[model samples]
Target: MKTREISKRKCIGCGEMKPKKELIRIVKNKEGEVSIDKVGKKPGRGAYVCNSLECLEKGMKSRRVERSFKMKIEQEIYDKLKEEIVNE
Candidate 1:
């Protein structure tokens, strides 16, 4: 029998390794648009973060997302991502 390999990604905020599906993905598309990728299928470069607010806050405060994406992250994008995390 063959075992399936699970995908793993590091959280930009907490610096923890977790299953890809267990983390939220933020993507920057070819058009230079940044957005939360809930489905993880967006066509772009993706950064992962935990679903917790603490992690989200840390990521924002420390500019982890900005560093990962190599671009400035708008406050509204962070707010929207936080709302989604909190609601989940």
Candidate 2:
């Protein structure tokens, strides 16, 4: 019998390694549209974060997601992330 492997992604917010399903995904597409990607199927650069508001705050304060994606993250993206975190 073979054990299935769980895909792991590092959380940009808290610097923790979490399974894909356990974290929320934020994607920046080639067109430069940044949004919270709950489905994780969006095509483009992606950042992983936990579901907690604390994680989102930490990420926003430190710009960890910006570091991960190698691009300047706009305030609107942070707003969307906060909105998604709250909805979750």
Candidate 3:
């Protein structure tokens, strides 16, 4: 039997490489809207982060998401992401 390989992505916050399924994806759509891609199927540029407040805060403090998406992110989007992370 053959085993499939798992995809990995770097966490923008902690700068660690982790399995894609284990990280949270933040996507920016073509319309320039940003949101959390819970299913990881959203079409757009995506940035990964760990599922923790520390990672989230680090990402925010460093503005990694903004850099990855090449645009300014609203505080509301970050707030929404934080809420989702906490709820999860």
Candidate 4:
């Protein structure tokens, strides 16, 4: 049987291409809810980022995440993301 291909996505932080399965997905839902999509199955505009804190920092520094999501990001969300990344 042929192997099914997993999706690939590029990180907006460091401009690195990574498999969708390997990267963390951030999404803006239809109702404008922005959060991490662990299942990679969320509906709405999505952006990929590395699971690394460094990449997250870069993304935050450049506001790449906000630009990609087309919305303002809340500081609390960033703090939560940071905490998650650090723990991981």
Candidate 5:
């Protein structure tokens, strides 16, 4: 029998390693657009965060997500992410 591998990702907010499916993916595509990747199948630079607003705020305050993407993120983007997290 073959064993399946569980993919793990680090959360930029809480800085914890967790299963990929349990985290929210934020992607920056070739066009330099950042958005939440609910399906986790986007081709771009990706950062992971927990599914909680607290983690989102922590990532925002620490600038971890911005550093991960190596660019300046706008307030609108953060707001969008927050809304998504809340809805989830």
Candidate 6:
């Protein structure tokens, strides 16, 4: 019998390695648009963050998320992400 390998990703916020499905995905498409990837199927550069506001704040403070996407993140985007984390 063959065993399946679990996919893992590092959270840009908390810097922890966790199962991919357990983290939330944020994507930057070719159009340079950034948005939360709820389905994880958005085609583009993707960054992961833990499903907690603390982690999100950490990432924001350290500018890790901005570094990952190589772009400036707006307050509106962070606000949306915060809302998503709270709802989750």
Runs off by more than 4 Å, candidate 5? none
lDDT of 5 by residue, 1-72 (tens): 999999999999999999999999999999999999999999999999999999999999999999999999
Question: Which regions in candidate 2 have their CA more than 4 angstroms from the true location?
Answer: none
Per-residue lDDT tens digits for candidate 1, residues 11-33, read: 98899999999999989998888
What tens-digit string does per-residue lDDT give for candidate 3 at 18-86? 999999999999999998899999999999999998998999999988999999988998999999999
Record all residue pairs in model 1 with backbone atoms less than 3 Å apart, i.e. clashing: none
Clashing pairs in 5: none
Off by over 4 Å in 1: none
- lDDT tens digits, residue span 1-88, model 4: 9999877899988998888888998889888888888898879999888989889889999999999988899999999888877776
Return the candidate ranking by TM-score, descending: 5, 6, 3, 1, 2, 4
- The reply for model 4, stretches above 4 Å from the true place, is 1-6
Question: Over all chains combined, what TM-score does candidate 5 have?
Answer: 0.96
Give lDDT per model, in order: 0.90, 0.86, 0.94, 0.88, 0.95, 0.93
- Model 4, C-alpha of 61: deviation from truth (Å): 0.8
Rank the candidate models, highest lDDT first: 5, 3, 6, 1, 4, 2
TM-score-wise, the better of 3 and 5 is: 5
Distance from true position, residue 58, model 2, in Å?
A: 0.9
Model 2: colliding residue pairs: none
Listed in order, each prediction's TM-score against the native is 0.93, 0.91, 0.95, 0.87, 0.96, 0.95
**Global fold similarity of model 4 (TM-score):** 0.87
> How many clashing residue pairs appear in each of the predictions shown?
0, 0, 0, 0, 0, 0
